[model samples]
Target: MISYFNDYANLCFEKFGDRVKYWITFNNPWTHAKVWHSYNKTWRNKQQGMVGISLTSAWGEPVDLTSQKDIEAAERYVQFYLGWFANPIYSGDYPEVMKNYVGRKSAQQGLGMSRLPTFSVQEKSYIKGTSDFLGLSHFTTRYIIQKNYSALKGPSYHTDRDLVELVDPKWPDPGSKWLYSVPWGFRRLLNFIKTQYGNPLIYVTENGVSEKLQCIQLCDEWRIEYLKGYINEMLKDPLTTHMEMVTEIVVPTVFTLCILISAILLMFLLRKHN
Candidate 1:
């Protein structure tokens, strides 16, 4: 599979390599570190195009800020999700917390080895520093609390984390049941990535909400507000100017005029009320 992917990538580089400056080798592959090394070795010098992977994660906040266990669980939540992939690409191994937890669980299950994969010293060195940039996709935040699950629950990803995820009822739910408008979470996740991975070049590959109700609303006020809040939070970071962010919303030409008028009228009304 890896060799096939490499060959396919080589063909792409040979064809559209000149115009395409940035190429994402994979979007959230389960075992991607090896592929990164393979791509870098084969085509980096020849094609001169950057290769990166897109990782999507929601920020996890501790349910109780003062509770140490909840704080640990929140960190664990992120490590299990984002760090599961990012750690190997940047630091060359899975998070220590993940390794310890999974190892303990495997021991309890009478397994010889942990379900989580391991990398050798040389492999670690090779995998480390493989990505040119980190592509992040963030939308919402989850409040996490520590919850102990029996080892009998067995070697599953959710049970292994031993955390409970919750959401605030007050948070705006525009459309998707899972997606809430928690713009602040976007900033927190970005900062976490920056601190955790030495502030690597970041590109927000996906960051938007979906409408649950099927209707033709040209204004798309909810989406507009969502983008406004998230983008504003992103811009608050001084380093954000250096990063590349992408968000796409397609509006038809007929709706374009209607949206412009609505926006102007809304602003005017707000100003008059103020």
Candidate 2:
């Protein structure tokens, strides 16, 4: 780690200098640490590994909009899931409130020094504005409530927050068993990024739902519906379409049936004309 840092830092100043404006040292270290490392000890220690801190932004929607308890719980769930990693990258530290609420035993066992890693003075300075653009990978948001810790079992980070997540049965489950439609969470996440990081350039890196099965047809009405809602919400904020060309770009997909129809038509016309 030390050698890599020294090498990169030296290389940056010597060769790249002003040419290299952004540096993303790590991406998705949460899944890397929790899932990969937790699963196997040897795999965790392997060197020459790319340790990105890219994490799933588990946005939560309040089941009851008017209820203050539900509102607070929704906010708490956001802090526990999304804010846990995003806060550190932009702000240079973990959300202290989260650490306190997670309880002592959690600190000792699964997340010893916090699942969110700490940064040194030098590291923070390097990382703070390191991103030329913020990247967000999202799927669906879970609904959460402040349930007592007794309900949860296992030494997992989910239990640490003392909050339980629930998915609305109404949400159409296409692929993954866990994901549910919580459209508002996308808007909230976008707003949070704009407000927190001085409204830095953002790239919605991964923002679509999956059907998992290959047998699913290309006429994906559900995916179309998901994209339309989320994109419309995103468009509501003008700042999202700032001094950047990214938002303007849209690549249309060629449906499989359309391709097949075109091929068949071409063949039929060629034979008839010939």
Question: Quick one: best lDDT, which candidate?
Answer: 1
Winner by TM-score: 1
lDDT of candidate 1 over 1-274, digit per residue (tens): 8677777777877788778978777777765565566557776787777888899899999989999999999999999999998999999899999999998988899999998878899989978888999898888899999999888987788989999999999998759888999998888888889889998999999999896567765657788889999999998834333223221223355478899999999999999999
Per-residue lDDT of candidate 2, residues 150-266 (tens digit): 423555666666666788787777676766656777888778667766776666667888764566557677778888888887787344444343534321223556788899999
lDDT of prediction 2: 0.61
Candidate 2: stretches off by over 4 Å: 5-25, 30-55, 103-127, 150-155, 212-217, 238-274
- Residue 120 displacement in candidate 2 (angstroms): 5.2
Q: In angstroms, what RMSD does candidate 2 have relative to the true structure?
A: 12.9
Where does model 1 exceed 4 Å of error? 38-42, 239-274
